[model samples]
Target chain A: MNNRQILSAAIGSLLALGLVSNASAAGKKMDMEQCYGVAKTGHNDCSSNKSAHSCAGQATKDRDAEDFVAVPKGTCAKIAGGTLKSA
Target chain B: MEKPANDSLPCIAGIGLRAPHYCEVLEKLPKLGWVEVHNENFFGGGASLRTLLKVREHYPVSLHGVGMGLASTAPLDQAHLSALCRLCDAVQPAAVSEHLCWNSVPDMTINGPMVINDLVINDLLPFPYTQEALSHVARRVDQVQEKIGRRLLVENLSSYLSFTSSEMSEGEFLSELSRHTGCAILFDVNNLYVNARNLGVDAKAFIKALPAEAVAEYHLAGHSIRDGCLVDTHSTQVCAEVWELYEFALQHIGPRPTLIEWDSDIPVLAVLTGEAEKAQQRLEEYHACFK
Candidate 1:
């Protein structure tokens, strides 16, 4: 089947499953969408936070506090490349 | 009215629609109250956006975000925000949500997806719970809500370590944030369980602290243990302990849209449906009380 046919079948089957009715499916706001890195510690959002689950402990070498780029909202704005809106 | 109109999703359970099971789920159309997906995956539409539109024809899709860290120290990535807004316009999602953690740091730059910004960390990094941080987060959340033209539900983060400079607990911070920004809470049960185990946070107190009416959705996920601390790994099945905590949350906050979140090492469609079914059973028990 073509794309429209495939989508039609999918929506039809979804209705058949009683998961979503045609009325509600059409009516609903019909919405809606990882990593970790250096400067990243045990957490990434993965196994920890990035490594939180998926890449747990990928970067275990603890960096000193100075390695982190995080500053207060004020200082962050003053940094050369830290404009709120990028060029 | 018979029952006060509750705009939240049905009390039944749903699953996180991951890349692995997309074809199967779309083909089979398994029984689920709703389905959620990461917002970044569909940033610039192509086949992925096309598929999501078709999926939208079926299930109630929730736009759950991982990259839009509300507490990030960097300036709000308007490009990223615009991409999210475009996706929401196309999808008209049932609920739009993001993690309370901060991921945007200017240590690196993202080169793709129309993000005209310097480097942003790919991970969900933790932040201190100072008053300053809370104000920053509330303002950022307000920006997102205004852009989306809808209330954004903020999910609590699961961290391995605690910051020494933190002035308040994560739960209290979230409570105050809701009061300030009118943002709803996503209430990830697994994150709370992981934090309780790793950082000695009071799980019961965390649940008690949240504004119940502010909670828009509930997430149940599996985790793994490393060294001594529990990791919020969404790899395995939802553990028994988290199920108990979820039920406890239901008792306290009442039922809302519940989702089973299995991210990495995603299992087959059947496995996710099975987990969703288990949650559905608990929801039935919760719904009986309103009868």
Candidate 2:
């Protein structure tokens, strides 16, 4: 094959691989709000001072307990590792 | 007027009344011969205790304990015993029962399903039925009986493994303990069925060997299949095989205060009442044969 054609094919393969990896990674990301919704309804919220409707406070406390690291704004970098990041 | 003889429990069939259905059962006042509840669940005076008190007004309640650690080498938990005594005073349960197994150890090595070193697994733990173990269990039973100011029924546990060092059979240990402590037996038919299938223990021999007169109650529950063995998950409906075993037990041991126990994935009150009705039918049939 010609050198130009070979270079074009190599670029195409890398782009395809990147897209596949991104798609796989995207599948792992969970919607935190949806998870909170399920937990609020599914389990008995035994948090002493908070009602079930105020689950946002419990979620914040849980996130704080895990020392969760938030993703930087305006950056498409990979999220930090932890259950909260996945959520 | 004198209170009726408590010995009449042998002719009744009851259901394990859990928290979820307490209000409905008490409000509707279902025709339950008796009701049993886990003693641990009502240790503290709260909504659960209040509900149980209301139910006690209408039915005879049996306090079945799940966390006594009767055979544990560790010192008996005073708090647990005190809680039980308090409950006994409040509810005046017709009978109280704990399992014939250990869930704790001395050197902080807890033995049970969910263990964290010295901490108990919050589940019953089976042990080898050696003479020493029997003596330990008997002593514990004696203490529980003394504290409660009444006889305590010890239930046979459904075990997954058999220890190579077991010096005697579970039935022998239980019979011997009863002889020594005068404690009653709560003969759980489902546990025997599970052990018979999983550990090659003979269910018929177990039923036959138990001292009939000492049997104060019977427990029937459903189990789930796991890894080719049956675990007493108590989540679903009682299987036909277990029900048949209950009938066999009723015939062998005679009708006793049988309980339909469903702990997890509990259904509506009607479902449990339906199961209790089945047991009541079997008990009535047994009574018919005797007559």
Candidate 3:
């Protein structure tokens, strides 16, 4: 078999053995909520408006715009002073 | 607060798991006594947490925090503590630890009602070793332990400066902190060596002054010297001087779960395992002599 045929056969074997799942399942559905103003300083997960450090554990100040932390869905609305929309 | 008699980490050498080698470690499933990762890195769900969970299946995991800021003068970050507790519930790690340093300060209020700055240094910074600071840190430790529902290992900091207004040595402060709050110490030998070279801290005295029973783990790592100051860079291999210090620690404090930490310019897995094997050898020598 050529490279493409060999790849297909391997994937077919995995599927037959129940070792692989569909694309949606493989994507690991987003069950998280982005809660803003709750991230601790230097612990934010991603980009923020105040400073564009653009990575985890790099937030210079606390509660900046778009410095959201991934929380359980629907949990963000419950935290006092926590907002879904960043200020 | 009553302290646990011992941590659950194996009394063998382990390596600090970093990002570069995650794939290789998972694929190979090498013989590591345990693995530690920074707590903040795996706080939220996604590829990072998923990858860690997969790695967790093979090795006992230790959650070490760098962002808790236990000694911050600002009010304790409740959100951070809650996230940590959630992680502990999920990971069920062998031990959890943080540094004895501060990273936050109260927001600055300018002339009158105008708020100016929200100061939060991302790095671990040292504070004066005074009675007041001790009381402050003790309360915070108690709070963290209470929230986490387990003992927290507080590590000594590698500082570049010392406070002349300080009332005690860092060792005494840690001893008193453990005594008062029942928290354990994560004794970093290289940190002590660095502080000694940088600011004239007495390394042996610091080791001897610690309550040995309260020491639950040992950290061995490499440092770099810049402009006549030894910086705890954790970028290179464990040096001969640090190994001597580790042996000294073994003789004085007895064997504990030791770790070889290389955070920057990380080498291959074999290199880290080689460093860990070096530590394991010394640990075994101590065990053999005692037995």
Best by DockQ: 3
Candidate 2 vs 3: which has more lDDT: 3
- lDDT of candidate 3 over B1-291, digit per residue (tens): 676543689889999987666766776789999999888877777556766777788999999998888888888989999989988888889999999999888867878897745478888788999999999999999999999988999999988888899999999999999999999999998888888888888899888889998898999888777667777778788888889888988999999999998876668899999999999999898883221
Residue B268 deviation, candidate 3, in Å?
1.0
Instruction: Give candidate 2 regions above 4 Å deviation.
Output: A1-87, B1-10, B109-117, B288-291
Best by lDDT: 3
Q: lDDT value for candidate 1?
A: 0.78
Q: Write the per-residue lDDT of candidate 1 for residues B1-291, one digit (tens) a residue.
A: 021222356667998876556566666787889998888877785546766777889898998887887888788889989999999999988888898887766544355544544556777778889999999998999899888888888988889878999999999999999889888899999988988988899998899778998887899988887677787778889998999999999999888788998876778788998999999899888874332
* Location of the lowest summed lDDT over 10 successive residues in candidate 1 chain B: B1-10
Instruction: Order candidates by lDDT, high to low.
Output: 3, 1, 2
Question: In order, what DockQ does each candidate have?
Answer: 0.03, 0.01, 0.03
| TM-score, structure 3 vs. true | 0.77
Q: What C-alpha lDDT values do all the predictions have?
A: 0.78, 0.75, 0.81
The CAPRI-style docking tier of model 1 reads incorrect
Local error of candidate 2 at residue B176 (angstroms): 0.6
What's the C-alpha lDDT at position B277 in model 3? Answer: 97
lDDT of 1 by residue, A1-87 (tens): 999999999999877888556566664443221111211223311222233212122223366999777645677766887666633
Stretches > 4 Å off in candidate 3: A1-87, B4-6, B109-118, B288-291
TM-score of chain A of 1: 0.23
Candidate 1, residue B123: lDDT? 73
